[model samples]
Target: MNRENVLVIGGAAGIGKQIVLDFAGRGKKVAVADINKKALDQLINESGRPNDIFSFEVDVSNWESVQNMMTKVKETLNSIDIFVYSAGITKQVSFLNIDWASWKKTIAVNLHGLFFSTKAVLPLMKNKNGGSIIIIGSGSAITGSGGGIHYAASKGGAFGFMRSLVGELGKEGININVIAPRVIESDMLDRLYPSEGSKNTLKKEIPIGRLGKPSDISNLTNFLSNEESAYIHGQIIIADGGRTFRPKSG
Candidate 1:
């Protein structure tokens, strides 16, 4: 029996939710931590494999909350073989309109929270001496588009942070990588391109001629954590369906 334990931060909705479902479907012991209690409860109840999935409440921006959640997760999961950082917040505001509160909050969730969560989980993953750390990054970090100045800056910091972390952590048999996705069908996307016309226009801009789905990310998440991707580390894989850096399609 394969008892690989997986922990997904901000796993109640969007891409994180799909990742949780994907792992649970494979019979992995999957745990979801999110700030939304209602969504967490609902997801657990709706998930057919209740025994395979567990939920934890966490405020990624709050260090104490993150610490408490990780402690509970360690006790329940016993080990964390794969840690996916998918907790992020974004807004499509103009640069000049960006206020201190908004910038701080965005950086807190997208970067500082990453710092806290990664610190909390590193010990557990190191104990196993072999694991994968997947950061749910954004193309905004590269293209300087989508969300706003704050969002792009935060993600850019996260990308650089993990790339540096890979140098040391990889030596310990853990691989840290970033998956920067764009134009995905997410709440953030809905907010950024609310109207049908806007969405259609953005889709046409993509060479794939469509918006990306959560599964596109979740599927790659699956592969990245597998043994086949062991050699892949410290890389930022962009999955935007040719919206930005177009990959050679099959």
Candidate 2:
């Protein structure tokens, strides 16, 4: 099989890092973009085929930085066949208690970063005729999760972004999709459910009786970024192990 050149933003830790390694292992040349230089270097060093993985330090929240990084990645890899937006942040605070500064910072990283990164790479993917773009979203987008209202709002905005992009770019032959997952055992989960009680309550709510794993998301993302998912576009596919199917208790 011919290998594709894939670009993953935030491909340094957690779910993003898993996706980067998965693609690289499959023989794809991966361009990893992240703000953490140390993590990026760690990923490169850990990848047995160092030549298959290129690292770029970038702040996806900044349009200029994203633009420049995309340019550099394109130059290094020649063309990008798959682009994944996995860079995001969250502030677990009561909706009313969140200050303006914290709210802005959350929005900047979660929503604005997705916008900037997607826009930066659209042209490059379009130039290659057609390519896949998968965005990592959260189940908060559809649920009333406490202490992460801003995060939910940002994820909801991403849904709107993906739906609109489908109409605008699907005809252009670009495959766009969003992968939303429930509480995964990542750094984000550690911050959101700090206490054992909080995590226990969440586990009880999920029908599957377990938290999500990075591979749960990476596997689906891998499929969505392939030609097999060509007919699957403009959809928000949830990979929460049937957690969101539970009914609310009175």
Candidate 3:
């Protein structure tokens, strides 16, 4: 069996890291592109699959950086079968408190990064047997909750960007989808619920009774990247243990 070649952007830490390790564990040749050189080194050195997992430094928000990374990917992996865009940052602030820098940074990494990555990878994917392009999005896009205004706006922009790509890419055999995971035991969750009491309270709101494990997301991501989810494209699947709800926001 020929293992798939996976390129996970922002895959050095958190949920992205989990996806990288999961694919590597499955014997797939995985390449992780991240801006954090420190985390990338730690991930590869500590992952116990150093040879199977390749690392590249990239600023997803920079088109030149993304293009350079793609060049490295093509040279190393030869071709990409799975392209996962998991790059994002969050800053919790009231709409009034939002600053231009914060909003711009959020949009650059979370939203514009998508434009850079998918645009760079499409040529590679289009030449192949129709690969899967998965974006690790946030449920905040739907509920307007958790993350601040800028975070919500960025994710919402990703939704719009992805929706536009579906029609253009789907017929070309490239499957595009967004996985919006919430309350996962990740750095993002840690940022949202820093204290144990807060986390516990948040957990109580979930129908599943606990915070989600990264594996929960990795399992679904693995499915989406494979043949099993071929028909599931151009959709944002929220995996939050049914935790999202609001009674008219009043």
Candidate 4:
């Protein structure tokens, strides 16, 4: 098996870190990119077998920075086989209370960042005859949710971006897909909600009986980034433990 070179944006922590580690453990060369230099170093140090892990500090929200980071990753690792846009942010602001600045920031990170990161890597992937672009969306992207209208809108845009990119790039052998996860246990979750009881209650309401761990999403990402999913394109796979399908009886 030819080991794939994977570049995971926002891989310093959370689900993105898990994806980077998983790919590295499989003997693939992994580039962990993020704006958090300390966290990036922490992931590299924690990996133990550090040879497979490389760190690049890049803010995905900045188009030029992301482009430069992609160039460095390709130069250092030869060629990238997979690109994962696992970088995102969400806030629990009421629609009426969310100021334009806050909403714009959410859009920049959650939607625009995905666009910049994926666009930067597409050319490199096209040269290889194809590669996988995985965007981490959210359950809110599909359903109406309170207090996170901006977040939901950004994710909805991600779905649109993935499908459109797939249509235009599939002929070039590139596969684009979005994996929308339900509530997941990660630093982002901790920061966004910050209430343990609330988080726990939300987790229990899910049909899966627990919040998704970073590994759950990472496992799905691994599959989508591999040869097995070559024929799969432009699909939004919801890995929310059937939460989206449960009857709203309450």
Candidate 5:
């Protein structure tokens, strides 16, 4: 069996890191791209520096950087069988306080990054005749928050973008989908909820009564990236531990 090649953007930590680890454990050749060189190095080290796992530093908000990173991925892996766009940024600033620069940066990393990364990998997948592209979105896109307007907008755009791409790429044997996870126990979550008690308090509102884990997202991603999920495309799978379904009064 030929080993599958995977490219994961924003793969240095959190859900992205889990996805990379999962793929590597499955004997797949994995290339991780991220803006944080230190995080990338830590990921490589934590993974025991496997020969099948490679890392690259990239700023997904920049098209030229994305192109350069993709070129490196192609050179290292030869071809990409799975592409995962997990690069994103968010701030807790209120809508009224959002500056033009902050808004643009959020959109650039969350929305434009998705577009750039996907565009960069399409040809490689098309050439292979079949591939999977999974975008890591946020449940906040569906249920908007007052402080994260820019984040919500960017993620909402991701949904629309992937849905539109379905018509364009599905026929070419390339599958695209978005996975939106909420309140996952990651560094991002830590930033959002500084106090440990605050994290626990938020969990009470969730139907599952626990914060989502990186494995929760990574397991679903693994399934979606394989042949088993061939029939699933242009869909948004929300992995929020039933948080979205809970009633306000519950």
Candidate 6:
């Protein structure tokens, strides 16, 4: 099999970091892009595959930054086989307390970033004649959350964007999909539920008896990037450990 050139945005921490590692473990050449240079350095150092893994400091919300990073990836890797958009931001703010600055920032990082990243890679992927684009979304888009209206709106837009792009991209042999994970054990989750007891209480409500792990989502991402998932497109695979289906009172 030809070694794939994978680009993971927001891949310096949490689920994005795990996805980078997963791709590298599978012998794929991985390029991780993030705004956090320290975290990117830590990820590259920890991987121990200096040649196979590279990092770029990129602000996904900025079009120029994303374009520059994409150009560098093309120059470095020759071609991009998989592109993952995992750059996002969210906060717990009541609807009444929401401000324009905060809302704009949330949408800029979450929705606008995805758009910029995807737009930057489309021409490259199209030139290659095949590629996969994966967007990391949230279940909050499905069942509205009180404290994260901007986050929910941004994620919901992601779903719509993927669905809209599949048809156009598919014609060019490119696949796009969204993976929505709920209550995942990630830095974002830590910020949302700081206490271990609080996490455990939420975990008990899941049918799987535990919170979703970064690996869980990365595993599916790996599959979706491979030929096995060629038939799947524009689909939103919810990785919530069955939390969405459980009764409200349960």
| Residue pairs clashing, model 5 | none
Q: Residue 249 error for model 3, in Å?
A: 15
Which digits, one per residue and each the tens of the lDDT, describe model 2 over residues 12-118? 99999999999988888999999999999998888776899999999877899989998899899877889898988886788779888887887888899999998
List per-prediction Cα lDDT, in the order shown: 0.91, 0.87, 0.89, 0.85, 0.90, 0.90
Residue pairs that clash (backbone atoms under 3 angstroms), model 4: none
What TM-score should be assigned to candidate 4?
0.94
What lDDT score is found at residue 29 in candidate 3?
A: 94
Regions of candidate 5 where Cα sits further than 4 Å from its true position: 1-3, 248-250
Model 1 C-alpha lDDT per residue in residues 107-198, reported as the tens digit of each score: 99999999999999988888785889999999999999977999999999998999889789978888889999998998878988899999
Top candidate by lDDT: 1
Write out the backbone clash pairs for model 1.
none
After TM-score superposition, the amount by which residue 52's alpha carbon in candidate 3 deviates from its true location, in angstroms, is: 1.0
Stretches > 4 Å off in candidate 1: 1-3, 246-250
lDDT of 4 by residue, 1-250 (tens): 3437888888888999999988888888898899999999889889996788999999878899988998898889877778888888777778889999999998998888988888788777777867888888887888855238998999999988887777788888778889998878887788776898988877767886887899999999989988888898999999877777876775
Residue 202's lDDT within candidate 2 is: 83
Candidate 3, residue 193: CA error in Å? 1.5
Better of 1 and 3 by lDDT: 1
Better of 1 and 2 by lDDT: 1
Cα RMSDs, all models: 2.6, 1.8, 2.0, 1.7, 1.5, 1.4
TM-score (all chains, Cα) for each model: 0.96, 0.94, 0.96, 0.94, 0.96, 0.96
Q: Write down the worst ten-residue block by lDDT for model 5.
A: 1-10
Better of 2 and 6 by lDDT: 6
Question: What tens digits encode model 3's per-residue C-alpha lDDT throughout 1-250?
Answer: 2338999998998899999999999999999999999999999998999889999999988999999999999999898889999999997789998899999999999988999998998877777877898999989999887669899888888888888989888898778899998888988888877899999998878887988898998899999999878898899999998888622334
Where does model 2 exceed 4 Å of error?
1-3, 247-250
lDDT of model 2 at position 166:
90
